[model samples]
Target: MAVSRHLLFAILLPMAAVAADFPPPLLIAHATVIDASGAAPLGDADVLLRDGRIVSVGKALVAPPDTQRIEARGRYLIPGLWDMHVHLLRKGRPEAYFPLLIANGVVGFRDMGGDLGFDEIARLRREIADGSRLGPRFIAPGPLLDGPYPTLPSITRVLRNADDAAQAVLDLQRAGADFLKVYNRLPRDAYFALAATARAHHITFAGHVPLAVSAREASQAGQKSIEHLFNVLFACSSQEDALMREKARALDSTDVDERRQLRAHYLQAVLDSYDPARAQALFALFACNATWQTPTLVQRRAYAFPEQAAPDAALLRYVPHDQRWRFDPGQDARLQGRDAARQTLERRYFDMDRGQIALMRKAGVRFLAGSDAPDGEAVPGFSLHDELAELVAAGLTPMEALQSATRNAGDYFGLGDTGVIAPGARADLVLLDADPRADIRNTRRIDAVILDGRLLQRAALQALLDQAAEAAAGP
Candidate 1:
């Protein structure tokens, strides 16, 4: 899987695509358009795109003289999907994965955390932004802002106090970060200072609600989004204060036996303290504050059931054979080690996350669909489909699930010109072989992808996948 850069470029840089300096006018005729705005799909729709923007969308449209026509008579069309969380770090071979995003119709994604010194990451981001690169749009916080003693020292900016936190925010923004990503274990004072500094700089701060800050307080204080249901679960329980104190004490311990016992007690207390009323209040606060949620349910599944991470032939084709075997020791090695207690806790957390998601929706809390792609367990592109299915399983309708990856995603990132398929929106769309309304998994049946008006027909898309697989299975 150690591919030479020259070889990788040869395979991935499609000559035709690179040669097309200007996008052609394309007309997709007789397709079903699912706009993902809760409206019914329009049958036999004719869509027109010229120069990376949708020019016409209706029941009948005569193609322009220079238009390239595609007969999509029986196809279903939807706005392109977005993965709200991803990490295309250099170590992950981001170059090999961009095609996967286009192959799966993921046109936008967020790289939540990675090494700040990973120069290739920002270069790729710039390339995409400047339209020289073709793939998902990238939003990232260069590195994670963590407490004094960071777990991942190399990728972390250790902040000892509020002054350090404020300075870190300024430095990160100056370094080209789209937003600020705060990590767990950040001191209460430092986290708040980071938040305030980010606000002053007109940048949004999103990520884990530090363990020191309750979810309600985080929402009230303007934490933009909470990742992985981290603080929400504990903060919503009736035993919030007690559970938090116990969790804090347990986490601070060094002795193995004592920490294990305390963790067990804390988990049990969390399981028993489900409070619908408290959860309702918390969700209300989130809605009012416009705080978003990226549950990353796919990650939850990988943690709760590590056996599923076993890559089959199809999966291995996209991920390096060596990289496929390196994810078991992430969380105390609980997954690979198969610790029964950790499995039980992970499952509970997963189920609890589902419940919270249902309640959050009921309380009108907006959400975004994220796969945490290439994050050890989840596969890129494909995991977004899995996340949509998980959302439906968690009580969101197929439409609601789709919206999380579409409109909600666009709104979260303040990209108003995209997300919809109407005239004037960015012409990023997916042509499906089947109606996704019947089954969320139908989203995976991609027939074609319209990426920035560059039509990737089924055959071209397949070529992209094949190239990714070959790059992964290097000679």
Candidate 2:
């Protein structure tokens, strides 16, 4: 992807003259580079960037007289993070969320689903590619394909049958969507059709497991990734039919005790039927087929405590006031309004989130970290770090958790040169003041971020956040 000259002019006009004269290469000296490709961090190393690409990386490199140097000192430098799932649309100006992603140290994202039009999103992708926008690299699925009448406002297209499913994939491909998203309501035939068509066209199919399709069947049928852990829980169960039948009967009944019994039965069944060998086989299919999992733990956590007052301070700070209100407007009241029976049914779903994560990891599932942010209690940017922290709580090592956001995502998306710090790689790196390996929370101690050779200090990143907040507040 070549950066356009016009884009350069539009973005760098103020600093153009100062940047024109080939000043010595920007050198990041004496930093520990955690080059995310499973390599040992190099101590006392310097990375030199020129023309937005890494030119050299090693120790004992002499800095040229004209070289502008960043004294990394004792900081840890790693590849800029990637959020595999995000909704790039905001409340007022839908396009405002992109820059905010960059501001929070995300250099790239995969928009799992959003409300933006395909043409507009394509333009934004191009603009970011051309350097016309100060945003992270984007990959989008355009819109969702739902069935039995699309319930979500974000879904612009719906599949009525197998033909509709095939045509929907074609339309999404034509609209420049990078993948096809399957929703929960899709019919079995339509689900298979969508997956087959996507495979034939070399488009990745991802999202929820329809009620008619088991996770095992979907994996074998070429569904690229599963968004939530619910699908896996379904597959891991040895008695899915019995469980589903119980749930259906519970739904049909108004008796509180009956519903409670059914809910308890389902949870107990899940714990009893969780077979490690079966999980390993299922995850092997995922790994063999190059499938990915975007476990949006933040949303899972938020929904876990439905009766809670609101989101925590860190997440609340990033969301616009109106959007925050929209997400939690008397959520406690709503929870209270639900009969105890119905509340328990919903709560059962929440309790399985951590267990699902643990089971997936135990089976060697390839996890991709995502917040599902700015929707419900999950805020963007900052919420991603919370996801990392949650993954650690779920038994993933800090390095393993970080890999889910970096190298793992890049590999899944076929981005060859962006996830690791190496010669010839793009200069998207984060310099942290503390050792994140020691404590995952240390990732918050960001000193600076380098995006395609452009150094943004902490103040500049904060300014970007303020700009996003302002735009989100607009009429």
Largest lDDT belongs to which candidate? 1
Q: How many clashing residue pairs are found in candidate 2? A: 0
Task: Work out the TM-score per prediction.
Answer: 0.91, 0.86
lDDT of each: 0.79, 0.72
User: Worst 10-residue stretch by lDDT in candidate 2?
Assistant: 1-10
Q: lDDT tens string, model 2, 175-203?
A: 66767778766778999888888767777
User: Per-residue lDDT for 239 in model 1?
Assistant: 87
The alpha-carbon lDDT assigned to residue 327 of candidate 1 equals: 46
TM-score of 1: 0.91
Judged by whole-model lDDT over C-alpha atoms, candidate 1 comes out at: 0.79
**Cα error of candidate 2 at position 75, Å:** 0.2
Report clash pairs, candidate 2: none
Report the Cα RMSD per candidate: 5.8, 5.0
User: What ranges in model 2 sit over 4 Å off?
Assistant: 1-24, 63-65, 90-96, 130-132, 245-277, 307-309, 312-317, 332-351
